[model samples]
Structure formats: structure tokens, C-alpha cells
Target: MALHLYALAILMGAIMSIYIPMISQSARVMGAAVMGNVPFFFVAFVTSVVIALVSGQRGDSFRKIADVPPWLFLAGVMSAGIILGATFLVPRIGTGALFVLLVTGQILAGLAINQFGLLGVPAQPMTLSIAAGAVLVIAGAALVTFGAVT
Candidate 1:
């Protein structure tokens, strides 16, 4: 059941990877009309609040913020950068291209992160199969970026 749900979650993420940029492109236009050059921040602020409300209530009520390493705190900062970058780039490159590039980057970075155990995670040595899979993903991304999506 857990594995099924995880697969469903990945499917949902794939759907959102397409859907979100369309909404964000519209929001970017709205933000430009209402605010100035930094509409993505406004959109990000609202998104953060929604995410916090959904996530914050589910966990232990008395978690200690101070116990968390300061380095781990950068996740939110990184999320903001991703959101803002997507908002800026999706309109310029189109969603297919943007996500192809993004996924390619993610796979590459994930491979490195897993291999090195960077950011304090348990290191998993990169195997030949993993490298082959990563290469396949890159090739797929290249096709998605360059080929017609229809």
C-alpha cells in the first residue's frame, strides 16, 4: 500500500510539474500587473503559507526548532529559489523544456548527493546501474526538450 501510494505521489508530481507552470505563468502576469518586477516572491509567500498550514499541523505539536541544524534550514531558502526560478523561466522556455532541464539537473544532483552523502545523509555509493539510469534520464530529457511534445 505504501509503495502504491508512493507511485501515485510520483504520478501526481508529474501532473503538477506541467500544471503548476501554467498557473504560475498566469500568476506571473498578474503579479506584474499588480506588483512590479518581483511577482514570484508574492506567489511564493502565499504558497509557503499554504504549505506550512498543511504540513505544520500534522507533525508533533512540540517540535524544537533549535535542535535542527542551521544548514537544514536552507531547504526553505532553496525552495524559494526553485519557485522563483520556475516562475521566471517557465514562461521563457515553456513548461516541457523547463521541467526537462529541471529533472535532468535533479537526477544529476541526486546521483551526486547519494554518492557523496552530502548534507549529512547516509552515503550510497554510485553503482554502474545508477550511472546508466542517470544517462538514460539525461537522454530522455534531451528528447523532451528538443522534440515535439504532441
Candidate 2:
């Protein structure tokens, strides 16, 4: 089941990778980027509220969120920062390069999360494949940056 789930995730990611820039940059053009992800998370949260209002999805599924201390609101602020960074980055670097950096960050972050097992996330046992993939992503980002410069 895990293998199949991973496969599906990879497939969907591959599909999205082809189109994410178009969507993000379009939003950026409309000044969504400058809003610091107010639109991004607002759209997501509003959709969830709409879905709940329509489908009557009950609470307790997000019981864990309520468990969080109030001070953690900073995460929401940081998410906006990240969204602005990505939104602006899309126009400056193009999607391919922007995503390469995103991938690089994700890889490093995943490693850190695995190392510390933070946020109730299970620690993943890393193999050589993970390291190789990180190295490849870094190389890819470097290539894109160099190509764009030259």
C-alpha cells in the first residue's frame, strides 16, 4: 500500500511539475504574490470551509490543530513568506529553475525532519538513494542557474 501510494504521489507530482509555474505566475501577475500568500492559503482554507459547509464534514479530524499552542501562529506567517518567495521567484527564474530550488529545499528539509523526527512525523530511514537524489537535485539547480546566467 505504501509503495502504491508513493507511486501515485510521484505520478501526480510529475503532472503538476509541468504546470505549476503557469498557475503560480498567473496568480503573481494578479498581485497575489505581493499579498504574501493571503490568496494562496485563503483559497485553500475557503475551499475547505466551503467543502465542509456543503458536505458537512465534522470536526475532530483537525483536533490536532487545536492542540497546538497559540504561539505557533508564526507558522502561518512563515508560509506566507514562502509563498511570496515562490510566487516572485517564478517570474525571475522560470518554473524549471524555481522548482529546482524548491526541490532542493524540500530534500534538505526532509532530511532534517527525518533526523529530528519533528512534528510527530515519523523518522524516515534514509538510504543511499535519498542522498543521491539530493545531490542530483543540487546539480540540476546549479545547471539551471549557470545556464540562465550564461
Return the TM-score for candidate 2, rounded to 2 decimals: 0.71
For 52-109, candidate 2 gives per-residue lDDT tens digits of: 7678666665565788898788888876676667777777777777777777888889
- Compute each candidate's TM-score over C-alphas: 0.71, 0.71
- How accurate locally, in lDDT, is each candidate? 0.75, 0.74
Give residue 98's lDDT in candidate 2 (0 to 100): 76
Candidate 1, 1-150: lDDT as tens digits: 599999998998788696557556665667752232245456767887688777865345326566888988799788666766776777778888888888899898998898899977799998899999999999999998987757
Lowest-sum lDDT 10-residue window in model 1: 32-41
Candidate 1 deviant stretches above 4 angstroms: 33-63, 148-150
Q: How many Å off is the CA of 91 in candidate 1?
A: 1.3
Collision count for each candidate, in order: 0, 0
RMSD of each: 4.5, 3.4
